[model samples]
Every structure is written in C-alpha cells, then in structure tokens.
Target chain A: MKKLINKPEDVLADALKGVAAAHPELRVDHQHRVIYRAEPKADGKVALISGGGSGHEPLHGGFVGPGMLDAACCGEVFTSPTPDQMVGATTVVDRGAGVLHIVKNYTGDVMNFEMAGELVADSGVRVETIVTDDDVAVEDSTWTAGRRGVGVTVLLEKIVGAAAEEGQDLDAVLALSRRVNGQGRSMGMALTSCTVPAAGKPTFELPEDQMEMGVGIHGEPGRHRVPIAGAAEIAERLVEPVLADLQFGGSPGIVMLSGLGGTPLLELYLLFGEVAPLLEKAGVQVVRSLVGNYITSLDMAGASLTVLKADDELVRLWDAPVRTAGLRWGV
Target chain B: MKKLINKPEDVLADALKGVAAAHPELRVDHQHRVIYRAEPKADGKVALISGGGSGHEPLHGGFVGPGMLDAACCGEVFTSPTPDQMVGATTVVDRGAGVLHIVKNYTGDVMNFEMAGELVADSGVRVETIVTDDDVAVEDSTWTAGRRGVGVTVLLEKIVGAAAEEGQDLDAVLALSRRVNGQGRSMGMALTSCTVPAAGKPTFELPEDQMEMGVGIHGEPGRHRVPIAGAAEIAERLVEPVLADLQFGGSPGIVMLSGLGGTPLLELYLLFGEVAPLLEKAGVQVVRSLVGNYITSLDMAGASLTVLKADDELVRLWDAPVRTAGLRWGV
Candidate 1:
C-alpha cells in the first residue's frame, strides 16, 4: 500500500509522537498510548474519556483538551485498546467528581471500556459509561453489536464536555451524553475503501463503478453496493433515510456533512450544498451546520451525514467555548 | 471523475449555496460570486480579499468572517475569477480606510487582481496588493510565473486579517501581509492527481508505483516524479528543500502540514510525526503547528508543508482571536 507511513506496526506509536509534538497542550503517555490534557480542569468537574481504533483521528485523541475530552486512550488501527490502558487513563484523568467513558457502540470498545470501569471501581473514582450508537446504517456490523457510533461522538463530546466543564455531576454529564446520543442519527457511504495498516489492503473491495451505502468508520460493509450517481441524487439518498429514521423536524437542529477522510473538503461542501436544501424541504430546520471531516474512516473516499435535533440546552452547550485540537471555537 | 458533484459547471455555484447555508455568519453575493462577512467592521477598518480557483477550498472563501477576511471572490475550478468579480468584491468590502488584495502568484490570479485594483483605485478607495509566491516546488509552473503561492496564503491572511480587524490602515496591513509572504516557504507532493470537474478526468496521469514530487495544488507538475517512499522520506523530501531555501532555524515558527485534499488527517499527522524531529534536529524551533487540510487540490492524495518564521509580533498577531470557518480559536 502506498500510504504515508513508515511501517504498519509503528503507525500508531509514531502518530502519537507527532501528536505530542504538534500539540503541547496535550501530554502523551507513550507507554499506555493515552493522550491527556496537560493541565486538566478543577477538581469536582466531571472528566471525559473516549477512544476507539486509531484510524478515526481527531475523534478520541484530538478531542482531549479544555472543554472536551480530558483524556483519550488510543488503540492500534481498528483495534480496541486493552482494558489496562483504559484503566490507566481513567486513573490519571479522574478527579473527585468521577469519570465518563464516552464510547462508540463497537463490541470490542464497549467490552474493553466496561472491563476498565470495573477495574477502576474501587479506586474512589466513580466511572460511568455512555455508549453512542448514532449510526443508522446497520443494526450491527462485524465489529459492532448494534448500530455503530459515527459522527455524533464528536458533537456529543463537545456538548457534554461543556456541561461537565460547568461543574455538573457525573450523573448529569452521563444524562446529557445519553440525551445527545439519543437525538443524533448518522449515515455514511463510501466511494472507496480504507486500507487497514496491518491488513496491507483495503478493508473491503469496492468496485470502481459503484459505492457502499451506509459504510461504517472501520471500513465495514454498508447496507449494500449501489451504482455511482450524481451528488444531488446521492445527497438525497443519504438524507432521506436519516429523515425517515429520526424525527428531526419541528425543532431547530444541527446538520453535519463530514468527509470520510479521503474526500476533499471541496466536495464535502458540495455535498453539504446538495444535502442542506433537501433537509429543509423535508421540514428540518437547521440552526447550525458543520461541514468537514470530524469523525472519519481512514482514507475512505465519501461522506457521512449527522442530524441532531437540538434544543436550547444542546445548542447552548455546542456554542460554548471549546478549546481542543480537533474542534475549537467561541472562546 | 467520481466526485460528489452534480455537474462540472455547477460545482462552484452549488458549493457557494452550501457555504451560505453552512455559515450564516458569512454572506454570499450570488450575483457577484463573492463571499462577504455578513456584518463587516466599522468604517476605516481595512478589508482583506483573497480568491483563486474553486478547487483549493477554505483558502479564500472559508476564511471570510469576523477577524480574518471581509470578503472572498471565488473563481471556477482552477480558473481565475474575472477582474469584474474582483472589482465587485472590492467595492462592497472597502470601508474608507482601504482594501488589501491578497492574490496568489498564479499568472491568471495575479493578472486579474491587478486589473481589479486599477478599477477600485478609480472608485476613490486605495488598493494595495500582496502576491504570495512561497511554493519552492517549481520555479515556474504552467499556471504560475514563479514559485506558486501555496499554503502560505492561509497564514498571511490570518496574520494580516487580524491586523486589519484591529483597525490598522491599509498600508500597515499590506506590510504585514507582504512580510508574512516573505518569511514563509512551502513545498508539496501528490500521491495522486486531482480531477477537475470540467475536465471530467484526472488532470495528470500518476502511476501507482510513483508520486509526483513538488506537485502544485492545481495538479501542476512537480520538480520530478520519484519512487513512492515512506512518510519519513517524503517528509524529508518536502521539508529539506524548505529548510535549505530559507533560514527557519533558531526561531519560533509556525509549521503547517496541509493535506492536498485527498490525504487523511491521520496520515497528515503521521507525516508530521515524521517531519518534526528532522526539523528539530535541524535546529528549527516550532512554537506552533497546525496539521490539517487547509489548502487543497481537488481530491489529490498528498500533502504540503509550509514553515513561517515568526517573530514575537507575528506570534502575537497569530494568537489574536480570529473567527473564520476554516480556522477558529481564541475567539
């Protein structure tokens, strides 16, 4: 594979080194592969930690900083981190107010985070877990037991992290995280497949003449393969199912057209241009929209759409000042 | 081309519609094809306007907001916007203070912006131009007369835009823009060629076994085609020329590893991880670093590095709170 990497085995470790160098605001635990805020918030404030496979960047690691994730336990490419790593991260980031494990609905990730929570239970730091299953693409994939969590994890971390920053109790942060997860729905399609570093090949074979609809972030199979079509038709196809799956109307909402890693930012905007009008016609009032790569399938060429039905609280928290390597604004 | 676009001709216009829908904080003049800050600063505040072909996104259009740019005129894919469009943008964004035209050093862009400046000069508004030719990849490419203005334009816009937002007169802002351009150097390589919508095919043929070294953002030829190497080797190839060409060592500097559209952020970080130590070994002190897709060729797989030697004044201006769709923090 002609990737910009040295060796498959060294990709995660080398990238973490880059992260430590690029962002001095974050401190990297090289041994455990955890990224923590250099100076975490005050005591009694809820701490947020989320992670998955390493390929979906800026997700868990890049989100660690003020007003977002306090720590991120990174795994190898598409592999969940060990429970020991998660426990180490939880112990390091947790203050008296407890820690929240914001995890995607992956079977391995869910199991590992749960095991880590059990390991940390007697350490005087209460640990609660909120699993995000916002992807409506499939009921379950090879790696996931249920619907996979995709883009909503990024939005949820920001909104819930803001509430945590306001000194909310762990239970309240968990409540807000679950609420955000409940309101968000995401669907993704891939024009091309991503190559896992270890596999040395694309996760799945995608024909040049077609695309995989409802693809997962780990390069998992989508709903089905379909002939390639124009962006407007594709935007309609992606949004129609989302509108049907969720009651996103009757309230101001947040719409995101996130690029699936390989697609250029130019086409992401073009897709959002096509997707926005279709949503409005379907009675969705989009108060805020983010169009870029947030959560991504590594080098998969296409896009995903997430529509979150936002109330005043979610909107306010989303607008709150957040300082992170991935998403930063309003500060 | 399998891009998410309806029609090649409609891509720019359709993307502009999406820009309007995504960022209500920025206003879109559909008739003039310009993106303007929804509400500009007070009278006597200098205005910044930069534009190029549409494929390199978030360069000029996404930078329009409170602190960065007052207006951005967009051209078609890889085609310069006409002098008339630039004139229209200049007339609208210019307060009594003056307007600074930040033009890339492409032949068409420089020529068109010059013509527009002459038009705006007769309209009783002063217009000074700063053309950034920071790319060290090629001396003269097909579209450029000298080194192409690549990623440094983004840095220049932010530093100069902050100066303008602080109500600096046109001359001071012009000086800062030129200074940033002079202190910056950039070089890029593409793993794959970008497909322009109108071309409906890849702009250039790139074999899988090799990469285009020193590739331009518009898919222009690089210094040479080289055998594909690892990220570390590629980083050295891109960074070495930049270091040899300029004195970037012994000072705090801004280093950005920008994706040329198709490369994933994960790979960008991996490349940066490989690039940082070499820079440090060369005695360059990186005070700040930005790793993401800032400037891009349409769906080309590769990355470019831009190093801007920063002084205390430049660092202060860089850290100043600026709000834009592409880069936002400290605001």
Candidate 2:
C-alpha cells in the first residue's frame, strides 16, 4: 500500500512534469494532460491520435511517433482522458491530411474520444476514428460496451502508423485499422489482484492458490476464477477461449503472449512453453509470435494472450518498419 | 517475493507450454525453447530472429511477428538462451533472403546469438547481425560487455522487422537496425529489486525510502541510489543521465518513458508529467513519445527513459502500421 508519490491529487500533474523534463524531445501540455511529439506533423500528413485512461503505460502515449500516432491524451489512472484533452491533442497534431483517432473499446475512452472527435470535426478538421474491440473476454451484446481492447491496440497503432507514414489516405488508414481489429483477439488472466493507489488495496481478492481467468485490463472480474495450476494449464485456460472464438487452424496467425504487469518473464516464458505444443497440436500455424508485458495492468500478476489471423496483405504490412519510442523496427 | 510457479526447474518449460496453448498460431520449438510464427517465412524474405535471457519478456519473443522478428529463443529465467536454441531458430526461420540476428548487448545474449549466427553461416545461410547497445547507464568499453540493450531493443526489433517486411535487403535491415542503435539511448531506475527465481532473493536491496537510479534491466546495480523522491525528482534523476549521455537538441527526437516492472501506471504517468516539461524547456523537440513497461526486470518497481533522435524518414516509419501481438496499429 506504500507509494512514493506526493499528495495523491498531485500525482498525475507532477508525473507529466517529470516526463517533460526527462525526455528533451517531448512536450507536456500540463493544462490539458496531453503528451505530444513536440514537433507538429508534416504540413499535409494526416495526424494520428489516440488516448485513454492513464494506468496502461506505454500505451496511447508510448505509441506516439511518426509511424504511429501524432499525439496522445492521457487521463487519470483508469479514467479516460477528458474531451478537452483530446480536443487539444487533435488540434495540435492535426495536419491537412486530417486526424485519425484510435480509441480503445473502454466505455469511458469511447465516450471521451467520441466527443473530442465530434468537436474537432466541428472545428473544420476532418476527424476519422476506429475503435478497437480486440478483447474476446467479454460477450458482445447490445447491452454492453463490448470487449475491451487489450493488447491489439499496440498492433493497430504500429500498422496504421505505417500506413499514415506511407501517405495513405485517411480512409486507407482507417480501413487498415479496422481490418486489424477484425482479425485480432485477446484474453487475459490475473493471478493476483492489483492494488490501485487510490484504492490502496487489492482491486479484487484472488486467493494465493487461485487466479481470475478472462480478466479485463482494468481489474474487472473475469468470467471465472480457478485454482492456480501449472503454467501449462494456465496457458490452456487463457488460449483455448481465444482459439474457440476465432479460427486459426486453416491459416497462419500472429500471436502475442503478454504479461499483465506483475507476472515475471520466468512465468511468461513458462506460459509460452505450455502454449507452444498445444498450438502445434491444434494444427494452427503461428506465422508470428510475441511474448512479454506489452499491454499491462499496473503490477498485476497475470498475463494476456492476443492472436491476429493474418492474410498476405496483413502480413506484409506487419513487416513494415517503424520508429516510435515504444515500438521501433528497421532502424 | 512470492511467485505462482510450480518447480524452479520447470518454470521455463511450463511457461512455454502455456504460451503454445494460448497462442494457437505460434509454434513452440519445445525441445529448443524457440517460438515462431506457425507459418514459416516466405521465400526470399530475410528472416529476423532475436533471443536472450528468459526474464525479459516480450523482447525477443513478443517481437516475433511480421515487421519485427521471425523467431525468438527463450532461455531460462535471467539466463541466456543457449547457442543451440538460437541455431535452431535461425535455421528454421531463415529463407533464401538471409537471416538477420538482432542481439541485445548483454554479455550472454550477445555471445549466444553470435554463436548461433556463426553456426548458421557455416551451414551456407547468409546471415547479418546487429548488436544493440543503447543503455547509457553502463560504459561501453573492453572492461564491460557494453551498455545493456534495454528499451531500445524493442524499438530496434520493430523498425528492423518493418524493413525486413518491406523486403528491404538484409544489408538494409542490418544497417537500419544499427542506425537506430546509434541514435537511441536509455537509462533506467529501480525502486524495488526483483528476485530472480533462481536467485531466490531480491537481486539488490534498496531501502524502503530509496530508489536506485541508472539500474539495468537484469537487476544490475544502478549508477546511484537515493531516497525515494516525488515523481518530479525521480523523473529528473532518470532523464538527466540520458540527456547528458547524448545530444537530443538539434532535431526532433522520439522519447520513451518506460517502467521497470512493478511500478504502477499511476506512478509512471506522474513521472511522465514531470518529464515532459523539462524536455520542452531544453529545446529538444519530441517528434514522438512512448511511456510504459516495455523492457522490464521481473517485478522491479522503477522506470527508464529512452531518447531516439529521429529524422523525417524514421519518424515516418515510426508511424507505419504494424500487427504484432505486442504492438498493433492502423487495424
């Protein structure tokens, strides 16, 4: 329950200051809680923007760069960024090419980004958006917000960022992003509940001998809580649901095994070990795989699995070069 | 100091099994501890491969996908993957386009991948390699293995992956990766030390009121340890070294404020708040920025700052679309 922050209310503001000071390249919009590439986009390049609650580090913000997003609005921990913040980001990063807002499927995130997009459009800037609902953990229904966008957001930003970088039209970027969401799925489990600083205690009680399966990134209870089993068993619990939800058997796929913050690489690798054979046995060929803490829940001891079924075009785009702070490739 | 693993020896194997099961698309080379896309690389595509100690999740493994890496070799927790494992991965993923080995600058990781590259080359496979030495925390010299390739490795893999995906020749990919390494720098801090399962205790001790600055990803001692300060002070301590180590002022640059596992997103954002302004005031334009737990140390509670001086081309690539499990964008 102990933390190193000064007055709880001052935590977010103070952290923004630190980010600005630490990296000479970035600028913090303190009044708006927006972290942007200090440099604006090219005169005619469409600007890509995304944002959400603050708890997921290296997410909306980490993805800001040329091949990804131009600006990211950060909200409070587990709370979506306000409309005003999004508006500022959109206005700042907007180029003649318009702006594409990558909104996660969280209720708060969707609401806020939607409002900002509307406002920016009203201001004469063309605003287009694609909401990511890659998490298959929740049942999609008319009554619900739908599945949360867990790990696939990272992939969306990188791939779409590439398209935007190639000077692809806004429609092209949006189409590519939608295609990514259509093909990707994610499911997560939490071995131990995370203690939100504000909550100052475990968000949910998970017995030492048990884990919450199909958990959401924001500490929401999962579909089931089961006895903590071996890595192989846990891997099965996490992956089976995903495979059933999507068919990967007839084609090649890209998979991501992500830690939910607190889980160590030791367990992650063990989980990966358990996952490999089962996948081979399933007759599904994984064309690409990623394992680690990419999308995380603040120090929560758990992991998530994401799979993206790839076609020839998706695979080619996947192999493009990027140069963002969080994901850089091909130099 | 507690974990959910069954037996110490079974950690890696058990985890890999879980990975295989969860990600049906990924094929696990259980015998060799390698994870690859279920589908082999296309003919004439230069295969990209990377691996290292097991604890650094999502590094070599999470990066195995289109636009990043073709295969990742997982070693025992905190231990380097063996030469044989890397050899297996390289041979399997390599196409006639040749294979590019992206090795972090860790002593063991470099040696193992180097050995594998040599072995693959002996078999008549064209191979190119680049060692990322982006950690500014350690001195690069004969006395040491060199700066650990902490956060920058993720950037390297993505950029290189994209280039390889674009079918840029092997030499191009290698050159681009090296360029990224030369332009990027990282420095990290640890608030709490992680207990490597094998070590069975905290890797290093920090008083409850103190934080370790310039800590490496593998629990290596930092440049200094001081009483835990407000997020503002902590951000300064982490970023000052990175700025001092390189010149980020001339052109726009990319910045990543990454958490060393166990640090909550709340703390990370607070740190970012403090970091953003300092950079702006210093006249360094941040063209892109990322904040999150990218490269981590088990559950160590700390963060690192990475700066990549970027140009229009790199920035454009930074915005490219990617579809990996760890990072996805555009769709």
lDDT of 2 by residue, B1-331 (tens): 3564667777777767766665665788889889898865678888988888776665666666666778888888778889998888888887888888888777787877777778888899888888888888768532237677778888877777777787888888888988999989888888788878767688877887787878878787767777777766776776788788878877677778776667765576667766776776666676677666567777788788888878887877776666555665543
lDDT of 2 by residue, A110-164 (tens): 8888888888887899999899988887775222377778788888787778888
TM-score of 2: 0.66
Candidate 1 residue lDDT tens string, B1-331: 6778888889989888889889999899987789998874688898889998888887889898877888898999999999999999888887888889999999999999999999888879889999999999888889888889989999999899888888788778988888999999999998988888898889899888899989998988999998999988998998899999998878788899999888888888889998888888888888889999899998989999999999999988889988899999778
lDDT of each: 0.89, 0.76
Task: Name the regions of candidate 2 deviating beyond 4 angstroms.
Answer: A2-4, A21-27, A38-40, A140-144, B1-6, B12-193, B198-229, B232-260, B264-297, B303-331
Clashes (N, CA, C under 3 Å) per candidate: 1, 117
Quality class of the docking in candidate 1, CAPRI style: high
lDDT string, candidate 1, A181-276, tens digits: 999999999999998888988888888789889988988888999999989989988998898898877778888889988898878888898898
Residue A171, candidate 1: alpha-carbon lDDT: 86
- The best candidate by DockQ is 1
TM-score of chain B of each: 0.98, 0.95
CAPRI level of candidate 2: acceptable
Model 1 chain A: weakest 10-residue lDDT segment is A38-47
